[model samples]
Target: MRKFYSTALVGAMASAVLLTAGCGQGLLAGDTGSDEKKNEPIMLGMLIPQSGSEAAIGPYMSNAAQLAVDEINAKGGVLGRTLELKTADDACDPQSAAAGANKLVTAGIHLSIGGYCSGATLPTLPIFAKADIPMIIPAANSQDLVDQKLKNVFLINGTGAQQAGAAAAWMAKDGATKVALMHDNTSYSKDIALRTQALVDEPGGPETAILEAVTPKESDYSANITKVLAKKPDYVYWTGYFQEGGLIARQLRQAGYTGKIMVGDGSVSPKLIEIAGPEAAAGLYATMTQTPDTLKGAENWIADYKKKFGTDPGPYSNQAYDAVRLAAEAVTKAGGTDGEKLISALEAIDGFPMFSGPLKFTPEHTLSTGGFQILVVKDGAFALQDALQ
Candidate 1:
């Protein structure tokens, strides 16, 4: 759900070239481009999962986008014109996300924000790039997206590569000499699992005892369980979502294998506790981007957000908020809604303060490597872990 106003749209947007038209006596008044640019609204799109397996995340994403919109509007709107948003559900699936991206291009957005699941977000990149729309990815962080090298795409989240490195480092710190790397064969999960496997493996790589893949969304993982238990590895790193991850944790405990368990970024949902039960979920490590609650100087904002939204902002909500604010600020700084100008503005950002952290984008348009945080399920919630220990 989004709101738009034609009358207030882009009224204040004026290019430096256009503003000086009247100052030059030789220039014709008709050549001033303000008339052409001011009539269009500063339209932005949200390409997030409103419906799908990840539908649970829609509200949090929407709330963050709306919060940014509200704050920008209160500050006299971006570029002195009202900012508007149009949302299209990406559904966290490739085909669906592509359709949503097309819908946004058809609506003629000035820019776009939001991309959650990497599987869904990947296929939509071409659509945004082809339309010349700058995309600000608040959450999706697949290495594939980075490899694509599209100029219009920017990601505030750490890449899968960074996440994998974090996991491998934690394993080393934990003294997990014989670790088992497992994945559920999903794009997001498998990518991290494979990369982590490579990092932890010897140059020649490890045997089957250290690597495995499982079918996703299955209620029973006993078949895989039997195979894993046979190895007796000291730690199991599951690069997958919480639904299956929780079950694996429970089964590991049931099978009486007591080493340690850690999950990938996608498995950070609180529902993991429900899936595995509180007891089994306890002590399970999760490699994830820091959420608002865990970030320094976010306590009051988190409290205010909970009061306003009726729930703690979900995974990536803080980043989503920062993405929106960044887009708005960049558009204002450029003094117009031009996509190219916005791209330049985004790249110029250096440690811009956000609730999540002081955000800065690299040359590749992704966040820095140290964005990840190690979390453990302590007393049914994800709390920061002292990884050194």
Candidate 2:
């Protein structure tokens, strides 16, 4: 699924660097002291769920990565060497993620451009940190990822904290006096749930009716819905993935407990509509980054993706694509794939073009603007409801 190559340009550049820098201190020749073989392709690694309940998203992210790689290679490659993408299956499980991270490190990837489930992504952080590989995370936005304070980690997606704020704000604007928060207990889900609870408990915010947790992958959630309906909340928010979220949505609607139903980004998949049934899923709301269908002026890109993959681009595809381009840019700006240099180059990025907006990271290494918008499930698809301006 990957290709590598060395060109005369790369060999010449390496010879030039070695001649001028002199092999003294930590400064080396064209190899950039990164110890990579001269003229070898710059290796990029990705860890996505090739097999798991979330496997539906694997193609969206991986195919986008390949698209970026092909585009970059066609344009003279990165740093005179073509980029090669190697992937490992994280399976959206912590143990699997850890093993996959190690596999990527051992394979000698210069950078990582993947992370979908925060629960799975969390365990891989220390693994990558220990190996000194900089990560340009595409999806997984758990604040816990930032709390670790690992310099090698950089999140391109909005953080969980930002999503929580957006969710709570939307609830207020909808005139909800009481809200129920539900989570699947995954790291990503729980982070948003806890943060939203805190924000809604603040002065002038709505009353939090209940903070509920549900076991994921369960077939039934009627008991949980019963507990929630007992609270008589005017609004309900589910901060979890689509599988459980869809069932919960359908159950809530069946139980006649719907004031309004909204979900976090993880629940923005079309499968949500299928699982909940179109009627039940109708009018469903989500706090999400712009998807291919909702992004303006992206018709051509989306068409190309469809032509390539034989289907429409899904959620997180643009983010994954951006991650690849950002990785290539960092490598170019750094002059090599040295992890430390790449980190510095990424920190220095300012106003780079991205589908969400101009790209810039805060001091905390999160997007300056979360780029979350309100999306509603209408006629079995997600469309922009509010840009939150």
Candidate 3:
């Protein structure tokens, strides 16, 4: 990550000012006395899986966000107002996410910094747009999100196209002549699967032997395995969440297919190893941006997280933290919670420090470089393997 100086530091300080300032009068609120309104907290909203197959990840994201909130509040709060976090469960479902989005909007949140699943996040775009709430999405990087072109929406996670290219390139680098791509057919998974297929089909890349979709939440996937094994692929890539991905990994190994196995960012969790069994997951690889364990120069940050939550931070935790800081920065720059002003403030950001690197959104409001790395399941934990420079 790049550190800022001079004017950049001044901009950062301004954002810190916004985070610490007492909440000012909101557009919807009554024009109460300035003194009373100034002491109110600025509400930040989040939506994540709380009671679904992806429930294990909710705390990781939410807690990190709260941690950021706590840090900012400790420093005396934004615009002189303290920051408060309000959360609703999306359960990684589209309908659930839409309802949750509406709940957050009704609650008068100034900004949004949550979205773990792309399919779940997609439907909420219009919901937030209608309410004019700016979203600094920490995860859920489906290319479809960018396609929506919602001015109020921005992503801090790497997009599917970037992950696809990283996956295909890694497979080819491993000398695989035939690669099998699989997904659960969700919008996010399918996008990565299809894009990877296209990349591998390029002139000098590996051949796409099979592109298969399996229904999620099934106990048995022998039929799908049968199809994949028939192609004799030297490499297999699974683009789905941890629940299904873990099962597929174990099943593929149990079926006696010994090819290299890799998973997408959605599947890069410690729970994947648990579900797949340590032995089955030992050689697994993942295409992902840096996670807490895999990130360099994050010891103090991780230590602080463990101290506050009494548990180790995981995937998306850093992103969630960065998202909150980014939101505060924009708020301070914009001088208030006005949607259009916040959008312009975020767009104008340059050289902001993030776990990924210097912050600058492309025209589509995505990172110019996905900053993906190759990770392997070493000793039952995902560890960095290559930077893919």
Candidate 4:
């Protein structure tokens, strides 16, 4: 068990913003606890981007986490205590993430979950290391975070290599001869692309004609399109977010280039179609991160989510929800809020039922059984083409 001390922990816990949207006062219903346990709510900290470019995902992560907390509490609570969620906005920046993590530590939370962006999540690892709080990561699957081998940390989502390996499987199945792998300069994008490039570079794989980098948020990509089109690769992979992926897809299609544009899982959201328009979005393929509807036994969960939030679960919602649910379960299994015990419990988890899939953490603290799937854009929507091994 870890004890909180007064260090330069961010401006007290009160200074941070709460992610619980409405009716936060009654987050858990019908949980009547003993007088001693009533005053103590299990605080679980969530550090994610609530502002900045990746803010669009904040609601999905927080809402899903809150739902898990509510569900756990509704079932008589954990360890005879009600779970309370505390959130801090990392803003997808390293410095801000460290500050936000500090707020969580100062709040004396037992454990923490919710990390959307890799860059933001990387810096906060050391903070949690020092605080000795078990950190359960929902997304932010960069290799760098896992390479550190932090005992206090665990990632529920598939790592970049695992995801890229799946892409390689789909590429081989599709019989792509020549390939062009592209990425925006972000750490997350580069890491996934680099991993995929490694797989494609291996023997029995397609020839990578052009490995290129594109400026994110640029309205025009004619230069890139022209340069890459010269190689006439059979497939082009864009390992970036939805905006740039859609833009480049639109540009390439408009330029009369007939090739499969495979956007990475990070960029395969519905927003991609909105940005690329109907014509360009059609006939495109994208790798997918976990989605609620795609996961097994998640139909009821998705319906409940839609009923509660008025929208379907987004990219990493299942990951976020599972992270919270598993973390809470670990706490219960450990029989207390002990960081080392929680880590042990997490490592020992075997075929745990989650919305996304049955999960068991590998030696690297990542999911042991999972891979990405290729989704083709039909009628301007992501549709399953093939499952990657």
Clashing pairs in 1: none
Per-model C-alpha RMSD: 7.0, 6.8, 5.5, 10.3
| Whole-model alpha-carbon lDDT for candidate 1 | 0.77
Cand. 4 Cα-lDDT: 0.79
Return whichever of 1 and 4 wins on TM-score: 4
Model 3 residue runs over 4 Å out of place are: 1-11, 14-41, 50-56, 91-100, 117-120, 172-177, 184-187, 209-233, 241-259, 269-280, 387-389
lDDT per residue (tens digit) for residues 1-389 in model 3: 43232245456766455443444324323433343355678889999998899998999999999998888787667777889999899999999999999999999898999999989999999999999999999988877899999999999988888899889889989898999999999888998999999999999868999999999999799899999999999899999999999999999999998989999988987899999999999989999997887776678788889999999998799899889888888877666677887899899988777778778998889876655889999998988887665
Residues forming the 10-long window of minimal summed lDDT in candidate 3: 24-33
Tens digits of per-residue lDDT for model 1 on 224-279?
Answer: 88788888888899988888998999988998888889998778888888999999
Give the TM-score of each candidate.
0.77, 0.77, 0.77, 0.79
Q: What are the Cα lDDT values of the candidates?
A: 0.77, 0.85, 0.86, 0.79
Report lDDT (Cα) of residue 306, candidate 3.
99
Better of 2 and 4 by TM-score: 4
Cα misplacement distance, residue 37 of candidate 3 (Å): 6.9
| Backbone clash count, each prediction separately | 0, 1, 17, 0
Runs off by more than 4 Å, candidate 4: 1-41, 214-227, 254-256, 269-271, 274-277, 293-297, 309-311, 387-389
Whole-model lDDT, model 2? 0.85
lDDT of 2 by residue, 272-385 (tens): 999999989999999988778787667767877888889889878989988988898787667777889889989988866677676788888898864687999887888888
Residue lDDT tens for model 4, 1-389 = 00111111111111211211133224422232232244488889999899999999999999989887887777656666788999999999999999999999999888989788989999999999899899999888888899988998898877887878878778878899998999998888888888888899899868788888999978999999899999999899999999999899899989998878899887877899988899888889888766765554456678878888899888788788877778777765555576786788788887666544557888888877664667889987787776442
Ten-residue region with minimum lDDT total, candidate 2: 1-10
Better of 2 and 4 by lDDT: 2
